[model samples]
Target: MRSEPLRFFAWNLGLPLAIALAIFAVFDLTSLDEIISNWLYYPNHEFPFGHNRLFENLTHRWPRIIPDLTGEAAIIGSILSFIWPLMKPGKHDRLLRLLEALRIAPLLRFTARYRRDFLFIVVSFAVITGMIHFFKSHTSIYCPVETTLYGGTMEKKEWFENFSLFHEAGPGRCWPGGHASGGFTMVALYFVARRHQWRHARAILYASTLLGAIYGTTRVLQGWHFMSHTFWAGVIVWISALLTALAFYGWRRLASPAVQAPGSAPPAPEQALSGLG
Candidate 1:
């Protein structure tokens, strides 16, 4: 209700960050990771579920297309916004008459209206995925399957133990789950809806969270990653979305004026976030 930046940071970044820190700290002290990994693994230390056709198609393979299609669609819309007119029949050349032939005036109109939000979704997804990839490459933490617990060579190490000056012989790029992060990027839709003041924005946010959890869970079951890996991936996506939103749309948007309820008295001067200055 008051101080939008504070609220934004608390919900969008702070909470997930705090949970990640907790998982990071606590997971090191417990066998929770191995416990879950062991349950999913077979007696022969094999992870057959990781290679199952059902999981591969439903979880690993199909969900990936969402972000790819979303980014591609956003790019196409942005390009059309620039040339849809010339690309139409009336004022256009032969090759440029794609829009008219396709009869996408409705889509073009929506794109024109929410051009910024759509573009921001692409940017936010790119930034989140990029950051996750960078960290995954750098962290060098072994995934469950890659560990001795699941029949690999690398010894399980603690959080601090993994932070050595040099990585071991087989360094892992599995700490922040890549596929899970991709699933989490659905939150970008919430940002777009929020920018347009859509009433179902919160529903979008909740559903995206659930979708990310499902995505991350599949990876965990498959032994491709630990739970913390997926947990941190979501945190990274959420925080990246917040920063990207602020970067694409200013912090003032985060600090937009509070909505007044019917028959409610006017708010005090301090009710808002001071407009993020």
Candidate 2:
């Protein structure tokens, strides 16, 4: 019973990771990445998304700030929650009072854990951003624009060529599209909301993935990333969110926190484990 979170972690972690790896494998083993990028680029014409005002303003520049700011804001919010327990609306507050009446005490109770929730969010964002950048630093994978397919210097290797971490010195370190990662980082917010069984949780997850896809697609259109790179970024973001949630609350409680024993002093998984030890 106590180990249900471990099971939840395995399923959530395995399923998404397998799907992401499958997506990358499809792109890596086939010419689909080149096929899609080919439609976007020609030796005669440049990758046009770079110059497009709509994409530049909306997707490229503006979105880059969102995850960074969100992480910082959540960190600050969590810290403030320590000083101000009223950061979230109380169960007795106007709108929540109605839920209290309707016996939706779970909502009321979970909302009080805003501090813990915010910690999960910021940590997930950190993991996504940090892991993405770490990969970007170590890998020398070229963007479509840098490859010869689009009138660049480097010979475009077959999509199936060994391209994972070529630590050798080169200008291109564009694996795992960074810009797309910013949008995908919002997935953590969805996980936190879902963990607490909040209303609109599904909407939050859908919106987050859509936003990431939009960001990643814009980069693909611009030749800054292969579809696989963006897919890999999604892998990083989703895994980070899931692992962080599991770390904070464990997989079982994340799946069905309502089943937690009443009067249990430890709300966090590690603390509970520590006491048991």
Q: Across residues 1-277, which tens digit of lDDT does each residue of candidate 2 receive?
A: 7567566766778778788769867887788998888877865487766678987887788877777788888877666544323323544267545555886444324333466777777777778778877777666578888877786888655323434555543455787788888888898887777676777888988888888888999899888888887788888888877878778877655687543355755223222222212
* TM-score versus the correct structure, for each prediction: 0.79, 0.75
Worst 10 residues of 2 by lDDT: 268-277
Task: Tell me how far the alpha carbon of residue 217 in candidate 2 is from the true structure, in angstroms, after superposition.
Answer: 0.4
Error of 2 at 238 (Å): 0.7
Residue pairs clashing, model 1: none
Instruction: Output the number of the TM-score-best candidate.
Output: 1
Give lDDT: candidate 2, residue 18.
85
